[model samples]
Target: MTRALVIVDIQNDYFPGGAFPLVEPEAAAANAAEVLGAFRAAGEPVVHIQHVSADPEATFMRRGSHGDEIHELVAPAAGEIVLQKAHPNSFLGTHLESTLRDLGADEVVVLGMMSSMCVDATVRAASDLGFDVTVVHDACAAPDLEFGGTSIPGGAVHAAFMAALSDSYATVVPAARLAQTH
Candidate 1:
């Protein structure tokens, strides 16, 4: 089975000094970069999914903004595919599915910023789309979120989402395990 690495939303906005920074963004980006290097070395296909907000009210990642660009740590090399997506699910309203099909990818390794959002959505969607999905737990990050009257810690949120995803949507693993697979 062919495997593809799908790096989702490793954008400047998720890092320090940018709007909507994520928890441990640097560490997550570093892990993602490691996975990217493994995939590149193995001659596997890599797809970088960039989230560009179309809503004017969006605080970060607005189209044409520097924050919307892919972060330097895990930036796509030439000949790599960079897909722009507006929705949290990368395949929605994007060419991601077609691109994956064209690349003959039957399994996909997913990682990136905002584990509770983009990563969560994309993994579930990828499963529904019939792709065997694997999420790199340490390669994704999420910021603290406030709900009702309580604040949920970012690490807790990330762990909960990853756990939930592993229950049905995708297989959750570490970057090291992914490298072993390749």
Candidate 2:
């Protein structure tokens, strides 16, 4: 069971002082850093995914912008792979799947910003692609969402999405678990 860590869109835009900041981004990023450290210490594969929008009118993560850069918390080290993606699903129009395969990974460990979007999409796609998936719940963040005139708090949104993903998509666990096992 070879394993790889996929850091999905932990970019500056999701952090404080950037576009589209999410709730508890620093806390989630700290957790993600810990998991990333574990993977590095164990000599496992790590792939950093950056969301770069090509649309000129996009409010955030515009290509070549600072917001599109991956946060320093889990920045790709020299020799590590960094994949730029235009969509929430990391595998779409990206070399993520092929890269993982090339790295001999059969299982994927994912953690990053916006639990309700990229994290959700990437987890589902990984599952569909037949890779065993594990999501670090505490290592992911989410922004508050509104639906039908109801405002959903970011915490609630994150929990709801994690719950949904845990039910069928992946085995969701806290960052500490991976740290211990790593």
Q: What is the TM-score of each candidate against the true structure?
A: 0.97, 0.99
lDDT values, one for every candidate:
0.93, 0.95
Candidate number of the best TM-score: 2
Query: Which residue pairs overlap in candidate 1's backbone?
Result: none
Q: In lDDT terms, which candidate is top?
A: 2
User: Model 2 compared with the native: what TM-score?
Assistant: 0.99
- Model 2, residue pairs in steric clash: none
* lDDT of each residue in 1-182, candidate 1, tens digit only: 99999999999998889988988999989999999999999999999999998898899999988899999999889999999999999999999999999999999999997899899999999999999999999999999999999999999999999999999989899988887866
RMSD of model 2 against the true structure: 0.6
lDDT of 2 by residue, 1-182 (tens): 99999999999999889999999999999999999999999999999999999999999999999999989989899999999998889999999999999999999999997899999999999999999999999999999999999999999999999999999999999999989996
Clashes of each: 0, 0
Regions of candidate 2 where Cα sits further than 4 Å from its true position: none
